[model samples]
Target: MTEILDTAVDFRATMGRLATGVSVITTRSGSTPVGMTASAVSALSLAPLQLLVCIGNHLYTRTAIAEHGRFAVNVLGEDGEALARNFAASKADKFAGVETVDDHGVPVLKDAIAAVVCDVAEALPGGDHTIFVGAVRHCTHRVDCRPLLHFAGGFGALRTPRHA
Candidate 1:
């Protein structure tokens, strides 16, 4: 037997069960940096080293990435929940008080678990969001950092089960 769920809330609740790594998608508008917290990021290809990020159509980061044709994905560490919340808020200055360094022309979080710079390859419309597919230009990672994760509408960390 199969059951059907026909509501947005049900869809969101079902989707939220799938845990995801958190990342800040950063881009520059002129000389100023803009970014947003995102979990809808994924590697699309390996032959050309490509990745895709889904950005809200109205987000400033989306516009900046479109104009600049470049972006950086900063994968947050386990301790970066504050940073994630800051970027996720609706504010004029999301970068205020945040520590960052310029990577080429994009801003990358200094303490993130990993960062990947990319040049936009394509932009596809997906309902209220735009999917930006990027070709990898540069990437850096820290082996010792634990990734921040999101699931069931909350941030969490991965824990290994203890063997008795």
Candidate 2:
């Protein structure tokens, strides 16, 4: 077996170098809407169109998602750094001044590069985080927008590829 090291800082630093797309995960808590900025999302399967998002167990959005049974993944565009920062904060009014629309009882960002509505299929314990496997129920996307990326602890935009 490989030796284990108690180096969370090192692990985070190394993982930060792996570029990831930013997204706002949203769900409803009673009559209130809740959301948070997240990068721990992935497509789990194509046969059944499933996705997974890892959220801190203590987070309000996590609790909301568990209660609501539904959530939306708002994939941020290149210009969504501000939105990402806003949602990343621990403020109560994260949605203030932000435009949104309701879809399947969940709030969806109006200008996301893509929005995916999902029904919770499974909730698995993942250390301090809970991995929610969701089945895609609906989706919308804008092909013209570039996705916002996170790398090295900072937000960035993807460089346009050149074709010969």
Best by lDDT: 2
Name the runs in model 1 displaced over 4 angstroms: 1-3, 160-164
- CA lDDT of 13 in candidate 2? 80
Please provide, for model 2 over 1-164, each residue's C-alpha lDDT reduced to its tens digit, 9 standing for 90 to 100: 26654599878987898999999999999989899999999999998999999999999999999999999999999999999999999998898999999998899999798999999999999999999999999989998688999999999998885669
Alpha-carbon lDDT, every model: 0.94, 0.95
TM agreement with the true structure for every prediction: 0.94, 0.94
Model 1 over residues 61-82: C-alpha lDDT tens digits? 8999999999999999889999
In the order shown, the candidates' Cα RMSDs to the true structure are 2.4, 2.7
